[model samples]
Target: TPLPTSSPRSSPNILITGTPGTGKTTAAGMVADAAGLELVTVGDLIKQRNLHDGYNEEFDTYWLNEDKVVDEMEEMMAGGGMCIDFHTCGFFPERWFDLVVVLRAGTQQVYDRLKSRGYKQNKIEENLDCEIMQVVADEARESYKAEIIMELTSNTIEDMEDNVEKIVAFVNGFRSSHK
Candidate 1:
């Protein structure tokens, strides 16, 4: 199916994405609340809508069906004003987002967070490697315009707060310019 073009809306659609333990969800919620945008946690949406093929034993996560996810989210994404949170960003249409925030955390911080969440040793190691390698940030660069992508450190509470502030400011700027 052809990808839909982004439609006009009152506010911009922001995408918060990174590796699993990088605080994507927390930052997304803060930015959404502070900027008055709707929060769409893609992981929750996938679970709620059964938008995945099946669960992956190794990763202890869903094998997401990208087509199904895009089909379900296309209309809402096109309309904008969404703070979409997920661990990855390559599949979504490039035009669907006005800004993409790629959160990054220190390897030790990511490892601790994943471990606390009960991630298996292998899973935790893999995620730490991915974060160290900047895999998600690379994906964002490949998928979106450089001007619209922001790579922010998410290692501390202060970093999270700063990220939220920067994003809210971006939203305000977007609102004014797009109007």
Candidate 2:
């Protein structure tokens, strides 16, 4: 199916994506608040909506049904002014977002965060590997226009503050341009 175009809304739709433990949820909350956008945490949405096909024991997570997720999000995304947060982005339609922010962090920081969350060693290692390899960033590049894809570091509280400021600025700019 051809992707639906972003509808003309008062604010832009933004996608904040990265490997798990990269502070996507935190940054998204701040951005959504600052920019007056709604925050959609994909993982939480999946669970709340039963959008997953089943659970994965090894991963200790749901096996997401990507198509279902896209369908569930289609209308909201097209309307714009949403901050979509997820660890992966390639499955979402390219036209849904006005901007895609791929957050990254130091390996040690990711490791500490995941470990503190009680993630299994294997899962933690897998995420660390993904972070080291820039998997999420690469996926964003492949999924969206390069000009709209931004890579930001999220290693410290200072970095989070700076990132939120930058993202809010972008949102303001988008609002002005769209107006």
Candidate 3:
């Protein structure tokens, strides 16, 4: 393989994926705010759809393709760099990116957060199960090259920021050496 360059040859689409109420949104927002990146939430897409919000019973929520979201983000790159944030990195096209960070949350911790946000019990439980089962991570691993999928645990706000920093440093390091 070619030696890593000093910076990203092109902008990278970074996905911060995790279960609901695991601070994916918050962490994504913070990263975007701190780094001037684009924040895209799949939940927001479902909410915007203003149509069907029902899950496929045993499966996790699905509103749209994270890759399409990344595509939209690509449009907003402003000819420089940007971060695209979401909860499911599964559908993302691996070759399109240099990195994919998967955030994880414990069931109880996740339940509490979702409950506090007024999520229904079944919805909360389903989401928690998705996290516990590592569905998102699995999908990401399968879709992307192993090197691109990163697993992170986020139990608190600090965890989210720490995860963000880890990803940021990774990106920065990647940039420092990549063409």
Using lDDT as the measure, the top candidate is: 2
Ranking of predictions according to lDDT: 2, 1, 3
Against the true structure, candidate 2 has what lDDT?
A: 0.90
lDDT of 2 by residue, 22-68 (tens): 99999999999988999999999999999999999998999989999
Instruction: Report how far off residue 26 is in candidate 2 (Å).
Output: 0.4
Give the residue spans of candidate 1 off by over 4 A. Answer: 1-7
Worst 10 residues of 2 by lDDT: 1-10
lDDT of each: 0.89, 0.90, 0.66
How high a TM-score does candidate 2 get?
0.95
- Which wins on lDDT, candidate 2 or candidate 3? 2
Clashes (candidate 1): 0
By summed lDDT, which 10 consecutive residues of candidate 3 come out lowest? 1-10
